[model samples]
Target: MSLGEAFRTAVYKEPVMVWSLMIYGVGISYAAFVKPSMIEPHSKDLPSAPPSLKEVMAGIQAKLNNK
Candidate 1:
């Protein structure tokens, strides 16, 4: 059979396996070659670290006073 016919038969016989392999291949290629940026805690766009213990107490007290 010709190349197209061979490919059609393969797909017809195991469509699920073929599609799963195709998805896995694309995922692996993306992870290996895309080089996605790493997120840094110190990035300017992110808010600073967690509030201090003192700051938390101050906020609680302010909320109580407001009520």
Candidate 2:
């Protein structure tokens, strides 16, 4: 069988394949229609040391998050 015939036969044989293909197609189409902007880089937006930890941390050194 030709490549096109093989693909058509496989797609018809597997019901899950058909449903999966439809779901994937719809997801790609929705993302294409609602393209979103990218986020800013982490390093670029990193905050500097707070000038006055008094108001923010009650005049104490900020503890590390240790994530």
Candidate 3:
């Protein structure tokens, strides 16, 4: 079944599943909006130029393999 159908089944057929999903959703929403992430505010902390192709390729590979 699709994600939507699975979610609907969880909500309608399983009250515990719905509560668990709601808790998970609230946690995710809180993290996305309420959390303060680390980021450099100064330009000096960043690179002066764009990254090289090697860095780009490595990043892509790492992301695809969940490294």
The candidate that achieves the highest TM-score relative to the unseen native structure: 1
lDDT of 1 by residue, 1-67 (tens): 9999988888998798899989999999877766454444337677668889999999999999999
Which residue pairs come into collision in candidate 3?
A: none
lDDT of 1 at 39: 40
- Provide the overall lDDT of each model, using Cα atoms, as 2-decimal numbers: 0.83, 0.70, 0.84
lDDT of 2 by residue, 1-67 (tens): 9999978887988788889989999889867764432334454676676466466674343454432
Which should have the higher TM-score, number 2 or number 3? Answer: 2
**lDDT string, candidate 3, 1-67, tens digits:** 9999997888889999888978999999877866645333565687899999999999999999994
True-structure lDDT of candidate 3: 0.84
Candidate 2 lands at a TM-score of 0.43
Q: List the residue pairs that clash in candidate 2.
A: 54-59
lDDT of 1 at 19: 93
lDDT of 1: 0.83
Task: Give me the runs in candidate 1 sitting further than 4 Å from their true place.
Answer: 1-13, 26-45
**Which of 1 and 2 is ahead in TM-score?**
1
Please report the candidate that would top lDDT against the real structure. Answer: 3
